[model samples]
Target chain A: MTLEASFGTSKIGADNIGVNCGTMLYNEVKQFRINHSIAEGKIKMENQVTLKLNYPLNEYVAQNELKLQFSEGTTLGDLFLKEGIPSDSVGFAVLNDTMLHLNYRLQNGDFIRVFPLVNGG
Target chain B: MKWYYGKLLRVNLAEKSYTVDEIPEELFTNYLGGRGLGSYLLLEHVQADIDPLSEENKVIFTNGFTTGTSMFGSSRYAVFSKSPQTGLFGEATSGGKVAPALHSTGYDAIILEGASAAPVYLEINDREVIFHSAEHLWGKETYETEDTVLREVNTPKAQAVVIGPAGENLVSFACIENNYWHSAGRSGIGAVLGSKKVKALVFYGESKTSVVNPELLQELMKEMAATGKDHAGVKAYRRLGTTQMVAAMNAAKAFPNRYWRDAYYSHWEKISGETLLENFEVKPTACPKCFISCSKKTTVKTGRHKGLTIEGPEYETIFVFGGLCLIPELDEIIYLNDLCDRLGMDTITAGNLIGLVMEAGQLGRIPVKLEYGDVEGAAQLLRDIADRRGVGQVLARGIKEAAKEWGLEDLAIHVKGMEPAGYDPRPLKGMGLAYATSSRGACHLRASFYKPELSGMIDRKTTQGKAEMLIDWENRLTIFNTGTLCQFFRDLLEWPNVERLVYAITGLEYHKDKLSEIANQIVTNTRIFNAREGATKQEDTLPPRFFKEPVNNGQDRITVEELQFMVDEYYKLRGWDDSGYPVHEEG
Candidate 1:
């Protein structure tokens, strides 16, 4: 659960954030993968994950499902910035069925869903 | 006199007489209109302890001060009466063409008193009130009733608010249906109408209200519409309607799943707004004079319920019939929604009752064979309840009375005999207080605190700072109700804009402080009415389940003591005593 700060490198070793790895480990392993193209200027596709955007969020994402590549230590805040979604516009996030904070580090093969800052009764 | 008609139509059904009475100017200045005016009239006219279904009870339909004007989101009307279900104050607001129609009839409100010897309907054309025999329409569904009334009236533009078999049978949660779609659907107002033996109130009028500053009102309305166009919340509502909340609520763990037992529904996507857009033909619909069309008209084209058209299975309807019942099929949910609308029943309370029956049956408290996810069985039960046949008779009494009769009172998920809307209060603590203190049983619209709590604007986990926020929201929403403006436009209408609208409509330039004082007075008046009706601090509480059980697998929980602390703070903020009674100033 620990997010490493090193860029272009697979620092996927420790559980620093105390995530419940026992249940999420299988989904992580199945979805996570690393592409080591060291010959190509060290462009690490190690944290490639799938993103699902629900209504209103999808209006910004332009699609319901997206496959995006994030830097190894990228958090939701970084991903939202890269994707041009205002951080303040996001109400909540769920990564692989577990609710996560904006600062939670993205893992390879992780599935993230972002919801807009909207509510109804 | 510009915004308001300053008159009410009084219909005495028992004597088959109708009269027009002038509304007091002081009452309008103090209470404004809509729910405020309706509540005031009800409190003054209806006896405190009379049976809601008795001949002595009164039903008042009130138009908002801005209703029928060129103001943004002003197409809403409030219906107030003593609830046959809760034996407390009952008020329900609806948006459609009916509000403007009623307003155009040259009346600020319509008061129905006494019971008719036979079923009848009223036709109001400007100031003329004509009583029509509704013998043929008595047992018809809402759609059929509206069609018949319109055909009989011979006016294509005539708008009728009619009750279906559910109301005729006096089901405790029956709702009044307008335009064969929209409903004032809570607290058994329809049942009260049923008791009066009135089938419909038809209006066919071309009259218009004069505004103080028409040009300025139009300019402000355009600006408000433009502001709404840029709002993210309005965009979401227009795109998916309220159904958009399914995914977000599930993510936040505020969704009520499986009769409030779980915080999340695993098959939520099947019933989410995305699924509706993907699978159905959704046509965006708007109320009269509304630019922000947030309602959806959907048609099921490829399912067992194919060819079924519905105005909405809005967020609450979807959660109640789909998530709470654990029914993953969207088609079935849409079918159930249509059934409730046609039967003139409140889908929230009806679905909650079904869920309770299923749970009670599982717990061996009842011999009923209903189980979770029984879509067909649930549909049949709804019809039976509307007709008051067999088990339907027991259920027509509502969950509180029904559960108590079956000795399963602890299992019912309700407050003051009204079922809570879709949000699970354990995760959103402010909603817990909102539900407990809402003037009409468990409702979200009374004060939609979830908007701030779920959007990260307020800390949902803490009880601190919630009382002040809740009071502020309640005041703002109370004004919205009195203004008769739709709550969807709340974000677009800031305080300054509201002051301007008031001036533009009524020529009464109220300052910000004046508006605030008016809102507080309205809230206090409603509280005093409830107190007179025997509501106490002890009745302001959540069900035992919220305190005893945890949601999201023990991740979110609120103890009874914590809820009490919040309630106490809320009372103090509202200038009420510790017992939650409104304190009055001595002369």
Candidate 2:
């Protein structure tokens, strides 16, 4: 069953943080969303769910955030593993300002921001 | 046999005499050392019902099993006594050369008992203990006291733990300071030290503990040094130190600024780690035998306080002054940190009390005209607290007393009369349990459960499995305290490394399970000590405001029911009664 979802074009992009750790990857990143292909009816939104990913995770693919798509109900843990990200790499994921667990099931058109795990400080 | 000193030095200040008691291997086998052994000694020596400020309350200094060895993060010692602040079981640990220095004195534990007739200091060189007049050093700041003591002792490479004016004044949150900045900086241990009327204890000796397996310990230390350099936690700390926590906690919407009226500070970046690096002259340094070097020896470069320097305004310090008091300037925060260090007061408690004063000013609860972001005012107030004058006199008694006298008890944020660390328990519910159930009051280091929660090892909101995970984290960290390893090494020393270090260093014939039992017993022992001090389930709770106020747009809050649920589960898991007292088990 396909759940109809309304998606918006996002202006969100990579933040230029002058974090002094010298360990972070600075990527030329931007937010990604579906290209309004639904009006052109060139895409089926049932099986494939398009979502936006952020840097650290995006550093691996070096692609637009919206270009990544997965099947419906994909968990964050599965997405991290599928992207070849180390299990301990990401600190947390935020969807619309709500912090997410790795077990959170991904929804279609969700824009998530993932951060690095910084602790012991 | 090896690595275990199996000796305790007991000093009677009243008689100005000392004696060496032989410890049994069985005691070392049961209680590892440092916090574990210190807890056991506190029970055996100090009576439960004595006034914390009385001479009947004994102060103990202990080194860990691996201390004075080649182990990384081993430069730490634990102080145990009845907390003058909480009037309950008290323990504080510090990292510096003091650990190995005290270890060199040829004793596992040094117990200071009885009050002296006049101010005095002790010089201990191996088995020799000399009593020296400290009437001149009595009023000096911690740094000058150390300089003067080392000058008088005539012992090269000697390190001394000294109490400053706040301690001399019997401020309930006074801390014992060493190396000018490193402090056993909590639990009112300094007051207990002061109550003994002894000014300082210098440790200098050539003795070294022979470990059971030097080659294996050497190999483990090598692996730690090699891997720790590239470790993410190590690198972050090496670069920015704990000051990075300001931004991270603020970003999580749990920075607890303006006396926790607001969880998020708008100008957090102004006083953050990045700002500290950009604005100050910082040189990364470390304790002896440590590679992580998480401490930043910072000096003010361009400010009113220029030329002032200190080891850190650690994360807890920043949170209290920068976050709680709303000091937007990192330089000012560093200055406050230095003030507390010199005064021999705990910055967390001092800043917290000052933050409360600012809140009362704002709330019209008190006549003081202080306000948030008042750096100069906070500095002056710190001096006042040390001298025990006016409002400082009330606050000198600690928040539990000061809050009531000012009719601000309802507004104070504390558990068991102690302030919480940077992580507000509201947003992170596991930290709620961490604070509520910690033997020490609202302590973060006990579990550092915030690490697991913030890192997404567990959902921060859920209380379902939090108790079990919190116990696991607390139990493991109890070993860190027992082993007296730095908490920063949690990433480097896993269960296997802990087992290997314990086996090689102490030869305890232990693994994770056996060591965990020792850790549990230590925790239970502390709980039993608190119980004897009249603490009940009522004390194992957060301030009312935490439960009532929902942070982050009302999205994050821990209800009384939620906290009670976790607390109940924590007590059950620790084998404590419904009243939160652990069942005592004889080793």
Candidate 3:
């Protein structure tokens, strides 16, 4: 299971500082790169999906003991639903402690964390 | 006659006479309500040139049109008069149950004129209004007066507006404390009340308000409450209250330590929201119909200050007492807030005055041994300031005057004789412009930019296009204050929805930006009043410190030249000249 992101590296707008982690929208990642290609030599899933991997799995989710898995071509919303998390309940998502939208699609081997709302003024 | 109670209650304390007069409808519409109404009426009805503390001067307490209703955050009333500090338009507002209680007593406003020979308190319950001798309440703390009035009135729900020993002694920065915690905390309004020999005003009524559209208003109320409760902005306040600001400000290196001499403190984290909640959090206080319970009730848990309990150290208090004074001890900041609250003085100014003393001591302006972060020394100074004793008498005159008397004029950190709030203007340049030209002098509530600037609502570093945005906000804020709606609404509710809400309730035809225009007219009218009273464009300038001293490490460093450029742009956007005077030519 992997999740990859695009444009989350730039702290550009209000949406960039999301409450938690993971890209909320898969389309944002798609737009971040003009062409999409999945990384090779990973767990081969289904035909309709592809995986793009970044960073080693051992270094992911540092300082927290939690198990999270992602599916290729899976939307952030779809991945959360698979984890039994409600769509309306979460305000932001993160791939690596950076904020993203739920509509973001997951690439292979990208560790992600979903977060609730941000209310700090 | 029914709508307005058909009369203004004019109390003349010097001659001990009271009069009632029918105020015109146009005047009411033009000013709207609250601070706008009070300022307009004071500027028009009272002589402008008189001394602020003179017998001829008047103090006007006004409630907005929506007050006493089930409207969310409608429980705000304003006190307007000439300030003994600025000698300009002095206006300050407070929120509690008091506004609704006063509004229920069949009056739009209470105008206190002249001066009393003896201390007195006003009691208005139902259809009756009476003046009682307040000799026993004189020199009493504000919280004690509120307690005594609420008990003696036999109404636990009665709202009491009280002044402390500071006001009784006529401290120029005196504030009026309402419901023990909420305060009309700026512009020296409490001193004005004290000068007239008034100690407190207590009121309670069983009356209900009648609006133009009851059904629509009910729906709007439900919506507004829900919105206020759920808004991220409002929720933040509810979560940490104003103390939430400490983290953000500290991160930005804008924490004005020791009167802007330093930007960081070693124990900054000890006085933050997390720390406050960990150390002292007993309960929460809320305004009328407001679910965002941002106010805190705190009690000391340990040490020499143990057992001391107070309602707050709201952002302004936390900033002035903790950040500005470089005192990172939460208990000490809480103690200072409690002292200022009970004393009926503006905590920001009180803290600023203490900062001046610290800076002066360092510079050898004062022979006494005063040092930054000295909580005990500062506590003693608070006592002296409240009683106007010894050196406290000089401090009681306010920071601007105190600095002059101490020969530390360059160290004074105020614009137009009012202390700057927590944020140093250098980091947020627009606020520098706001402080310089604010009609009521250096005030944060008049316009707060930190909410948008730091919260990613606007680009904090960009000063390119903020002039128009600031002007628009200033005008709109005037509408909210006058309409008696909470400023907290702007984050979630759009202006059109706000207009719809007001129109649905009051049946007023103000549409879209029309409310803003009406607000502009009110602001313009105020400026005109000041103009006639001899205010000049030259006076619309920041304190010398703001332009002269740049914060040592903050990212934003606005020079005097840069500030002038922004103010010039702001003047142009406001239809004013380079000198900050309103342009007379019609568009």
lDDT of 1 by residue, B22-121 (tens): 9988887887888779878877787777889999989999988788887878888889999988888899988888888888888888899899989999
Top-scoring candidate (DockQ): 1
Chain A of model 2 scored by TM-score? 0.51
What are the per-residue Cα lDDT tens digits for candidate 3 across B1-587? Answer: 23244346777777766776777777655666765677678767677588888887788888776787777777778788888878788888887778888887666778888888899988876666778889999989998998987777777557889999998898999999998878888988899899989999887777654677778878876777776654545655676777766755665455677877765555778888778888775577788777777677888898778999887778778878787777888888888888889888998889988888888888788976678889989889999998999889998988777778878777787887888887767766777777777877777766576555543344545677667767777876787778666666555456766676667656777775677777776776666656656788776777776666666544456676776776788778766656666643221
Estimate the TM-score of every prediction: 0.91, 0.89, 0.83
List, in the given order, the native-contact fraction of each candidate.
0.51, 0.29, 0.05
**How close to the true structure is residue B508 of candidate 1, measured as C-alpha lDDT?**
81
Superposed Cα deviation of residue B505, candidate 3 (Å): 2.2
| Displacement of the residue B336 alpha carbon in candidate 1, Å | 1.1
Error of 1 at B234 (Å): 2.2
Worst 10 residues of 1 chain B by lDDT: B578-587
Which pairs in model 2 have colliding backbones?
Answer: A32-A66
Residue-wise C-alpha lDDT for candidate 3, range A71-104, written one tens digit per residue:
4566866655543344544433445423345667
